[model samples]
Target: MLTYSRDEIAAYLDGVVDLEPTPDAAGLLDGVAEELHALDRRPGEVVLVALANGAALLRCFFGVLLAGGVPALVPPGTPTGRIREIADRIGARTLITTGHPADPPGRQLGPVQVETLTGVLPQRHEPGHVVILTSGTSGVASGCLHRFSSLTRNAARHARSVGLRADDTILVNLPLYFSYALVAQALAGLVTGARLVIAGPPFTPAAYWTAVREHAVTSSSVTPYMVRGLVAADWRPPPSLRMLTVGGESLDPATAGAVLDRSPGLEFYLTYGLTEAGPRVSTLAAHREPRRRLGTVGRPLDGVRVALRDPGPDGVGELLVTSDTVLRRKVGVAEGRVGDCLVGPDQIATGDLFLLDDDGYLHFRGRLSDFVVTGGTKVSLASVRRIANALPNVIASATRTYQAHDGTRFDLDLYLYEADPVVAEEVRRELRRQLVRAEWPSRIRTLSLRDLGHK
Candidate 1:
């Protein structure tokens, strides 16, 4: 069971938590909490948080929670117009951010009250919890609502199951807006009384390694791109580093192997989940049978149940998960009656296709929406992207089906990020060698990271 309370978290961070390039994070958290309580914001009220990663972000997040307001964390670099849109979509009337000229104090930023926190004001209820926005990769972004009790219910068990220690120092460089960073990195570190290290933006490979070596950082969270960058730089970590977790996307077998090869003594955790599942459902601990289960994302986390729905002949099916952490979409009443109200369904259909082996390991195939049929053959866009990303200098790839204006045949369109002409040719050649003719991409276009909506 998880024991996470506001008081407990405050006590845990009383003197231990450290935010680099800043002083006394614990004192800052207390002061921010106090300032938020001064707002007299009622419980269940919506507040938009648009602060960058550092002491201010942490302070404001916990402050809103402690003040009994539902806080929605927006990405650091979100534009003013989009921030207003998000706040309006969520019915938020209050916006909290760092003091910027655009967001003047005592002035309304669009339709919301702009409350700037220059630093912790002074020092400071809780049915309403957190609101996490989806990546909006598909289209319109939706908010995933999570109760504070539900989010922290299994946090302690999760930390223990993953071998996080109180003495360990966790380095988190990911955007704090995402659930992965909020729950897995910040909350987990605080709950376990671990020393939290926050790295600022522009997380280059050199800065990451420098932080790790300088702070003797023991654990850190990473994405596939970050891992690829580390491997490309041939950077070897210090002995103090013990755990490295990879998630937010599928970890290719080659990338996983390369990570393990470089850090033989380090424990690599390949985790899998969506934002709705409090962002983590399963983790493959590399210390146990490291190479044997390179492709599998391992079993479910403690207190979480996993089952397959509609298994195919090959046993692949949609992954269904039941956990206390699953978010229930909030339904509002219209015209004196509730419309299509659900009693909080026990299981969430992950919309992810997976196959569980007899040994109980789960292999992620791809999202059900990511599969496309070309020439009567089903091809996984994720599979194609994985293959394309394996090519050298390829940052990332996205695949979709396209058709000519006057053509009948459906063709695969592959978008490669940060790939030069030579790298694009190599990707095409490699894809031809690895995939069937029907599954080969019809068009491969190189694109900038901005073109793909990545920062």
Candidate 2:
């Protein structure tokens, strides 16, 4: 319930967002809200910021909010058609991209170039300006318009929880659109007045290390992919790094250990949550006392709650979330989280399944809907897949597919790779034993595991 006033959020900027056109921005933070208010004719207006760097998007985000407009900071890699669809679906009249200003705004585009954006507008939590959508990785692009306060509240609470200060320089690797990557690195930096350094494009390893060295970043946001990359490269993490937060996808235990081995003093943590819930609902402190929970997603943070519902005497049902940080509702879309809690006392039913141990640590299970009932009893394919994956040099993945032969849902496809066929066959047999009798797969095909390496 901590609401930000006027545009206190934008004034929180620490470094240039490094836009494509690059605004000669020095101290533009002063009267931005007022400036936009002077020209803005509507409230709750949405601004589509297409800035390159995370801070760039944030600048426009704060600019829009300060001006009384909701800022939907667009992420990188958005296709043009999707942008137009979103704009039309939301009835957006103004677009706040980079580049030269225009009257009619030229043409419609869902995919935008950062170097092409320009202009600022009034702020409001109205219908638009606020960012929408949690994980853009899902099918069809969408958004969840969050109040500036919600984003700010997370930053403030996180800074306090992590002991972040104004002197910290957050190294930015993930896009600002990724709620986890954006919130932990960009927003947290702004809230505490820390320097910002954008990480490189996805496949660029050198650029990442270069940024760390040049900017002297003390903290960073990352995922399992980056951790594996550092391990593969045998990276020597700069001693300047105080902490690194990883999420979006589960970080394999092996990769986590490898990362720690590479960088002795660097602190690592696993965060869990999605876009619909303002990114992080839980976090493991960097210096968590118990050393680190091997397969746990940690506990809920301030303003968030996690609960479990038992399906029966046999199984755990769902992981529930209740939070003000959770998005009220998604605009211009359907079939997602609707008006908070869908059932029970929990405000949000995370499709992801989980179980709380006697120790209070929550262990992640597979998606509830992902369970496959082959004979009579239902089996979690995720568990089966995880087991198959545990075999040395063997990786496993499962896909729930509809069969034309039986016209029934089945977890028929399980993709696994092992460099040697001898080992692959061993994996298939092990899977048969690991999975229940009813849970045995219909087909087990073997192929080259090198291409799609690890799941």
Candidate 3:
């Protein structure tokens, strides 16, 4: 288990790294932990952190853990409805945040902290619980249980894989609530004594570049959607960046090409992992980056093993993972690994099915349960999604020909038979060229789950 100490790094940052204006890492961690200790002394004996970006906010995050108290990071910008849900789920008597919301200060969740970048908050905790809430594809959530020690162990492995050095500055664009950001970026940097350059606020192209150059951000893990936005804004990241990793989902090849084109010196990676697996899992070797077209996420990392379950006796099924950094198990479940592929796995059977070529590179075939059944034929939904995305006018796509029979259930596919007048023909043409006739949809359709947000 790792505990963060910012002394030498603090000296290095002030004496060499940031040089001008930067927060003191040691003072910040100590203060935050101390404050949480004080807060624990209050009547409730429990407090929940729900802050946006602020120096104090960051401190509060670590402080809650240091104080040995449970801290639930309300993913920044979570809706008011979600805020209420989080408060209720955690049964928090006090919810902490940097500023008050526009609403009537939320009845049951009280007075926001309204962060001031003042002196450090105190350190406190004796170890109890750590919680992270994750949702289903349909958006229902279950609380994930973790100990602070589990987070530190995961961070140790993450630092080794990322080659952490005091000189490294990692651009953290993912939300702190995202386990990827916490384990792979924030905790990985803090535990290894490296600097983290936080940057989710205005999410602007200029703000991103400013952090990159100003902090000398050497590494970052970014999403493909964010990359597309930056590309649209006519921006390329600074070449000073040494490492780049993409995660959360597969990155489309077109966007990956645009990013690699800009930074000739950057070592790009496509990593795949989840919160259940202690966050750090397999990462593609930077050298294999040229192979992105196959849409391979990456190979497993140190202590992480990723193997595809045999499809029949000879092929692919859902991916099965096992590792030292893997989750011991999950809470609030019963006989549900099949009940929901997303739940009950230290060993995640990634419902996003895939196949290993003779060479061993993994290729995605949509969700396992999502295969469309047409009369008697089964079509891989992801293959159809890929075919649809390739066709012009198809922004994004999914397949639910099997689920379409029920009217109230309302699941749909990517391309519609009646979509763009020209698109239907174009998609049919592309699918025929790439897929067997058996893969063709009996009825093509457009995406309808706008409720599930993704760019």
Candidate 4:
């Protein structure tokens, strides 16, 4: 069942999957799959798809699966040279793209074009693998290897946990390349037979509201950055939006309160996950118990178990995750744990600090690496960034620790996006008021969004 036959896809797509108002989605997917089959696609060869979010991307996705090939997905804007480099690095023989049509030109499926490269490494049998690229801040990218069955199962669990129904319209505005948008949003919508409204990124309040109102979206998800944008613009969710989920970063209580205040009836879920753990570990229904559990990331999903390793007296330690759906491995220029083969069978050390409460809720403390010793006191850089980003004027924040010029100790440097002098001063006053002396940033710099390289 890892790969579906034409008949299976036809049966499933007839009534189960409704992507936009596009006609003959099944027919288009069939055409793509048949085209790949005729293009000499080997049963277990790897294929790369770098396309934007749309019906065409979905068609190519299932088409590769139906053609009995493993599909690796990357951002649609990835350059042709970079794609070929990735293909060579990952041994992918075929590429599905919207550019650089192959010699003798492969058939076009709507806006998608298939290109077969000649210089890929030796073909590998990977029919069960679906590669997802990680958007790490570091300059390198890694493809997370996931089994088709495990990802589907994870999506089903997430959809059920969040009460996604077949009749619901789920809005996917984030980039499809991210696992949060791919596995938890798009694939979850498909697994639950829900209609999907695909939208692109560079998320703005106007575009987000327009999509929700136009499509009558019943379900949607957002990142903390998007949440801040929505709140800053004072945009309100339409009546049709019944459930909203937040991921990608920890949602501060002030911002979460603003969202909840605007839409009292909406179900707001605060979730925590990384790409390595099949991208979803826990989700908290904050709207259900906003007064009691506003800061926690809720409990684990049905099949996932979370524990703290070597917890201190305060029950804070590095968090570890165990689940059947954890990633098999990472490939091609990955850094950190998986690159070192530190991930064990059905379990991974999350490298994040957390405190499991008596009620089983997981409260995220910070990343283990984000902490630095300053003046004989441990300081969490993530905390400083979180507090600064919580301010209304600050669009985004970043923190770095630099050794003193005198080589005495480490000093903290903070960068804020589009903050004025008044706002920066307020942030300084608030940090001193709320945080301990060691957690304060030694220097604060204000820069525009363009200067910070953010959208």
What's the CA RMSD for each of the models?
Answer: 11.7, 12.3, 12.1, 11.1
- Tell me the lDDT of model 2 at 321: 81
The sequence of per-residue lDDT tens digits that candidate 3 reaches over residues 378-446 is 234544455466665556665544333211121335634245556666765665555444455555555
- Collision count of model 1: 3
Model 4, position 46: C-alpha lDDT score: 76
Identify the runs in model 3 with alpha carbons over 4 angstroms from their true place. Answer: 1-47, 99-129, 136-141, 286-294, 310-314, 328-346, 358-360, 368-455
Indicate the TM-score of model 2. 0.69
Q: What is the C-alpha lDDT of each candidate?
A: 0.65, 0.58, 0.55, 0.72
Cα lDDT for residue 99, model 3? 42
TM-score of each: 0.72, 0.69, 0.65, 0.76
lDDT of 3: 0.55
| TM-score top scorer | 4
lDDT of 4 by residue, 1-455 (tens): 46345675454444432333344444667776787788877786778887767666677777788777778886666555556666777778777777665766766665566777886674555676677765341112356678888888888888877888988988888777778888898778667778778876656789889889987999998887678778889978899999999887677788888889989799889988777788789999998875568788899999999888999999999888999888787766654433543356788887788999999998888765544544322344555565566665667777766765311133333456546777677766765655545455676666666766776
Query: After TM-score superposition, what is the CA distance of residue 255 in candidate 3 from its true location, in Å?
Result: 2.8
Local error of candidate 1 at residue 347 (angstroms): 1.0
lDDT digits (tens) for residues 262-346 of candidate 1: 7878888888866667668888986676587989988889888888889999999988888878876631111111111122465
Ranking by lDDT: 4, 1, 2, 3
Give the poorly placed runs of model 1, Cα more than 4 Å off.
1-7, 11-40, 99-128, 136-140, 330-344, 370-455
Of candidate 1, the 10-residue stretch with the lowest lDDT total is 331-340
